[model samples]
Target: MTSPLDSRQILRRQLRQARKNLSNHAQLIAAQTLVARVDHYLSGQQTDKLKKVALYLANDGEISPHLLCEYFWQQSIATYLPVIQGKQLGFARYTADSMWQENSYGIKEPVTADYAPSRDLDLVFLPLVGFDSQGGRLGMGGGFYDRTFANKRPDASPQLIGLAHECQQVKSLPVESWDVPLQAIITPQQSILVS
Candidate 1:
């Protein structure tokens, strides 16, 4: 007899392992295609002027955001990496030379005395285990992103954008009350922007 929470955990484990199984060649190609999709979306849009964009370091089979980091640097958009702070998440400025350390989860984070609050970011790139076209996202079940960005108004400064591999897409996700919907989802195959 499995509880809903248990089922969710099972699904997460399956998805996480599936991604981890990706061949290095496959992951590399997916990473390249991902940046192309993101670039297409921002082609005509003035993303270069977006003051602050929050990004994450890949862990537990999450797709890498390293290519996008290079693109953002070329366009002069300040990049930030999420660090686990207390019970929630915080963003520290990420540069090529930023000092880094691993958090309790063994995820790398930029070590810093200063961090930018979520409210201060103009955009956020989320790493996900699974997603659907309707902007639903399945995170690592820690609720870090949910709690950190829970205060976003209908119209907010930062728009959350999910990054995933095409294989991560699912028919749908069971949405929880606290799940933060994304503005768009970018994958190696396509980009689905929420209306």
Candidate 2:
């Protein structure tokens, strides 16, 4: 029998392969599915009470946040995006037509002058490559998100939510000490409330 660590490695490799094999159309459908599910969640909740939110632009094989952005924008809620500066991240308000330039990794981000870090954000939506039922998240091997959350004040922690496809779910995942678990995970299939 394979050990848990070995199984995790195998599952990670298989997940990567499956994502790579997805056609553009299929990826769009998957993203739409997840977006609809998330929209349903938001529709049932009150957006006015949510003063601030952190969102990530979709990349790699993650579900697209384009529709999600429209929903939040329509509600007139404040939306923020992560800007990587070295090993740290600063959250910046992002509009549908926010001016963005590619970072070193080719990820688009808002210009520094437009950034407004919020320590009192009500929620944060994170992108995940893989996640478990308990909210263990695996990012793109970059610790930027983890480091950002680490810097949050103990009394001002934002509600962290991981966004991903249903296929990204695994039985378990390996986590490091510095890794901060999410409050919930939203997938194409269902929304998992970890706390």
Candidate 3:
């Protein structure tokens, strides 16, 4: 019998293959599914009061959240994005009309002047390369998000949520001590909430 670790490795390889096989239309459909799942979760009583939310600008095989951003902005919720600084990310307010410049990774980020350190966010939507039912996440091999969340004070920890397609789910993922677990993970199939 294969161990869980071995099963995870096999699953990761298959997940990668599936991602590579996804057509643009299929990906778009998957993105919309996950977006709807997240919207449902946000509409729930537990999350309805959250006024400040952070989200990522999708790229490549990642599920797009552009529509989600637009909907949130339209609802007058405060939207924020992560600004890469060295090896960590700083949060900055974002809107449909917010000016953005391409970062080193070619990802769009809010202009530096739009950054406000005093802002306290209620939720953060994290992008993941892979994730598991246990809330373990595999990032883009960069420890940026992990390090950023690691720096957060205990009292200031934001509600960390991961956005990914159902294909990105694995049986398990390698995790380090400093890697913060997600509070919830939203996928095309369902939302896994971790306590």
| Highest TM-score scorer | 1
lDDT of 1 by residue, 1-195 (tens): 998778778888888888999988888888888889988987767775688888888787788888888988888888999988887889999999899898898888998776888899988999999988888888889999899888887478788899988778888888899987788899988889984
Top candidate on lDDT is 1
lDDT per residue for candidate 2 within 1-195, as digits (tens), equals: 998557656776777666767788977887778768877767666756977788888776667777777777787877889888888888888876688889888999986465656566778888887889887878776788888788665346587888887788888787778887787899878998776
TM-score per prediction, in order, is 0.95, 0.85, 0.84
Question: Clashing residue pairs in candidate 3, if any?
Answer: none
Better of 2 and 3 by TM-score: 2
The reply for model 1, stretches above 4 Å from the true place, is: none
Error of 1 at 39 (Å): 1.1
Arrange candidates by lDDT, descending: 1, 2, 3
Candidate 2 off by > 4 Å: 1-13, 43-45, 151-155
> Cα deviation in Å at residue 189, candidate 1?
0.5
Model 3 residue 166 CA deviation (Å) reads 0.8
**By descending TM-score, how would the candidates be arranged?**
1, 2, 3
Query: What is the lDDT, from 0 to 100, of the residue 130 in candidate 3?
Result: 84
* Winner of 1 and 2 under TM-score: 1
